[model samples]
Target: MTQKIEFIDLKAQYRALKDAIDARIHKVLNHGQYIMGPEVRELEERLEDYTGAKHCITVASGTEALLISLMALGIGPGDEVITTPFTFVATAEVIVLLGAVPVFVDIEPDTCNIDASKIEAAITPKTKAIMPVSLYGQPADMDEINAIAERYGLPVIEDAAQSFGATYKGKKSCNLSTIGCTSFFPSKPLGCYGDGGAIFTTDDVLAKACREIRVHGQKRRYYHTRIGVGGRMDTLQCAIVLAKLERFDWEIEQRMKLGARYNQLLDKHGYQRVKQRNDRTSVFAQYTVFVENRDAIAKQLNEQGIPTAVHYPVPLNRQPAYKDICHGTVTAVAERVAKQVMSLPMGPDLAESDQQRIVAALSEAVKIGGF
Candidate 1:
């Protein structure tokens, strides 16, 4: 009998680090400083050093990180943020929640990242910032995007929710642009046990603003300086992340090795996947591949006990909530890719035998599904 395949295999990871995680959690429990505790600051410092950023502010979630970054930059009503329509709704959701507009752009078909070349044309007088997502653990064209932002005097926020451990041109993902925001959701490349996120920035003013914004916009206790939300990451969650950080480097290395192996295997089987660029390193957060008859293939795979998922089935611009706002915007690439992308089982602890079995199942499924 074939062993069951796990999509993310977080349980295996937990087992590998159970002792450390338990100790960290127990320490937090004993201290009773559940909010804004010492572990929170310690984690922040470690992340700041890891990413080479001037400051790191822990937040309640990835969405909160984006909101706080936008709030710190004074992005609000009547403003516009240019971003791809291919990413998770959170990227655009934060902009809309601020009563701002999200200008939808197309993606690069091969990489599924925002097409940086088209960004300049999307800029308008009302455009406040450019938010580019590092989709599927790969960085967007940051150098090119940053150059365009500089030309228009706009700030660039890297939505690095899936690309935490990735690198772009030798710099870490969350330290690549003006303000970088990343998620620590349990499924992400560098995840905690629960919802968590962080914002990285080099600017002193922006960093100070983000720190305040994460705590109800208060510069000090009970002294509100600006409008904000309750977005602080819990102390226990921070401790969990700190414990996980101990093996993060090793995990990233394994991801790279496995991603390369997957690429080679898929190529041999005549399967197509998201292409990783040479200048940057992707952590392969989802290990997604492009396929025809995605629904049918997924169904066939599931019957064989192989897990599969779709990172996104619809482009944000085509979604009901955003369609009217971004009316007439053409994202042909995003629309086409949405129908073809399917994520496979991926994790640091994935065994070679499991990977081979997954590919074998996929090969059979593709043939049976007539893809």
Candidate 2:
């Protein structure tokens, strides 16, 4: 009936930080150091302190961050990495790209994150590590996952692309595991202007390896120490993130408040909102909820001018790209969640009035979809 509201409201964010953002871009332009520039180091330092992690290495993109982390771990042909199939393909794609096997596990139906209990059963002599995606901005049960990894002496990498500002039991998302990888693809909780990403870690050797891998495995300039990739984050993108950091705290706070408000609104209306454990706080990167007749509901919401999307309508194991790679069985919970999960408008700049509008429209849509 009316024009759809912006899903992420990036314009609102830009309007709020126009001057600062422009100034940051202009500074980058003035310096003309686009690759591995001063701002890159500055942002890395800020992010390290923010995450309370010992090291942070900015990379070309979130996917690149994952690749670099895997490469640094010495994952190679024939190795198997345990991960979920309900996440963004990059979680499993990177492992497969390295010639390593992506051992698909199922996710927790409520959280749509890797089920820690399912991981141990999937491991084998070929299992090298565990990579868990922080789906919809909530960390997986890291304490349990870490415990399992410690017992097996395996490394864990948190795919925190959606959960950068999220917290788990008081620890930051990217700092909760052996290595954490995140993306800044503009729509993320903490995004940059263009594609950029980073890897977080406390291990000195892993950190060093990641740094080397990010820059073509060079020990010094042009001196190749090992096989690697050209994965350095651009300076301009770093500057944008640096500028956004000025308001990042406020943005994250708004996200948490909005998430709680969404939960309250949905539960008040009798919607089956996804449960968030008390020990973990989701940044609500997607503000997703489950309902009957998801497709019909999404269509009705679209007709009412509220833009909505599915985080993933299909699990990775079911995808064409992954089916041939893994001949193993898929998790039932992940498949069920995939059919029901729908992401509503989410971002720091999403207005309360807009949220109310969304909730009202959605309530109507759900009733229509149920029919």
Candidate 3:
């Protein structure tokens, strides 16, 4: 009998770190400071130390992190933020919410990340920032993007929602740009039990602005300075993250190893996957592959007790809501890949035996359907 596999085995992770997590939660319960408790600062300091960034501001969610970062920069209507079209909607949604246009650029076919070469051409006088999503837990060509931003005097905000714990050129993903934002959504690599996120920046001035923007633009308890949002991650969530952090490094290591193992297995079976650059390490937030007849394949996998998912099926430029707002330039690569990408079960707790079974089942499914 084949063992059942979980797409992301959060239960396994919880089991592995239950004691610490429970203690942290109990500590929070005893204090009764759910909103911005001491654990909030403690988590921030731990994250800052982990990423080597000068500051880390905990926020309500990854979406809020982006919005607050943009607000801190004073990005309002008519400003253009250049970014990839092939990521989660929140990447573009945050820009649109601020009344800024997300200038959609095509992604690289192999990695599904914003093509750094294509980014320079998208810049205009109205371009305020370059927001790059680290799709599938891999950082984009941040160095190249940063160089272009420097030439144009623009800030780079890395939408690292999927790439936390990943390293780019020996530097962590969230610290690769002017402002780095990450999600702690339950499914993310370093997720909390609920919505949580953090902003990373080496710039003190920008850091100050982000901190103020998260709490109704307050420098003091009741003082309001600039326009802001009520975007504060609760104490419970912070405590959960702190507990998870205790084993984060080891989990990231497991993800890397599993990703490599997946690569080897898939390659042996003549399957193609999203490419990882040599200079960077992806946390494999979602281990994905290129496949056709996604619906048929997914159905087959479901029947076999294997599960699959599509990271995205439509590019933002093609979505009805965004088609009108984003510049009408066609992102051919994004459009093509969106139709072909499919995610396999992935997590730090994935067992090697389960991984082999998943690959074998996938290989069999692909061959039988000729997809």
Candidate 4:
């Protein structure tokens, strides 16, 4: 008989939180304040305190959160936002949507984050901000990125879509930058039932700007204060997150412990893992690894009932949609990683036995492929 393994076991998590989640949903149903409801404010406060950010503005989605942050910073036409090509398209998409150019920077081969060393060289008079993605739940070198941004007087936006619960140098990922945006797209570290996201910031002015932007730029009823978007988080989603928070700490702990265990097992078995910087803690959003015959290995794992995924099969620079939008040439590291990276089953609810099974399958796959 074959044992079933999931790429991400969300059902297991739901089972664990059924009662709390049901109660929260019932509360939302009773209130009937779905849009920008009281639960929205409550979730925002909780997230703000969790991230140590001065303010948190919940939004419709992570994409909207990023767009609103860009709008808040006035990063519009003729401006340039420096970023990495290894990230999801949204990082660059929001830039283009605001009529700003995305200056693609190279990434560090190990961390797969925007190379802070290469950032200074990319700076130009048009550079408005440095947007570094915390790819795969590990934060980029914000200290170095922030230093470069400060030198050029540019704001830093951390696209922390995969790293909401991550930490760097004893500080949270979202709190490290001028502005941070995260998603609650169910697969994320702190996901809700449906689409949701939030913006974190220490700057009071930017916080206020983001709040206004999230509500169609409304400062008051029927009064447009500034250019904004319809990006409010739903009350039901907020309620779900509020309930998830009850066990979030424990869930983060489980992810960290399991991620470390995967690292150990893979290393002992001669599999290469995605490198996490020593200065930070990753929540193992995907538990990715690099393999010699990545596609063949993934297929073999699937044959054994061990599910796997690729965070990205292609680099943004090589994608059809991004082929012509380049402000610079593609980096060699990002290009190489796109073909080699594979994500194994990972989630807080993933059992130790299931993880061992995944490792064993991968080990066998490696031998089968002559790796």
Cα TM-score per model: 0.99, 0.98, 0.98, 0.98
lDDT by residue for model 2 (261-350), tens: 999999887787667889988888898988778879988988888888888888888998888887345679888888888889998988
Candidate No. with top lDDT: 1
Model 3: runs farther than 4 Å from truth? 1-3
Worst 10 residues of 3 by lDDT: 362-371
Write candidate 1's Cα lDDT for 108-145 as tens digits.
99999999989988999999999999999999999999
Q: Candidate 4 lDDT, tens digit per residue, 1-371? A: 58879788889999999999999999989989988789999999999899999999999999999999999999889999999999889999999998988899988887888899999999999999999999999999999999988988999999999998999999998999899999999989999988999999989999999998888899998899898888999999999999999999999999999999999998897777798888899998888888778878888988889888887887777878777876866588888988888899999999999988888888889998745
lDDT at 223 for candidate 2?
94
lDDT accuracy of residue 198 in candidate 3:
93
RMSD of each: 0.9, 1.1, 1.0, 0.9
Model 1 TM-score is: 0.99
Report the C-alpha lDDT of model 3 over 1-371, residue by residue, as the tens digit: 54568899999999999999999999999999999899999999999999999999999999999999998888999999999899999998989998999999899999999999988888888999999999999999999999999999999999999999999999998999899999999999999998999999999999999999999999898999888899999999999999999999999999999999999999887787999999999999999999888888888787887888898999998888999999736799899888899999999999998898898888888986655
Clashes of each: 0, 0, 0, 0
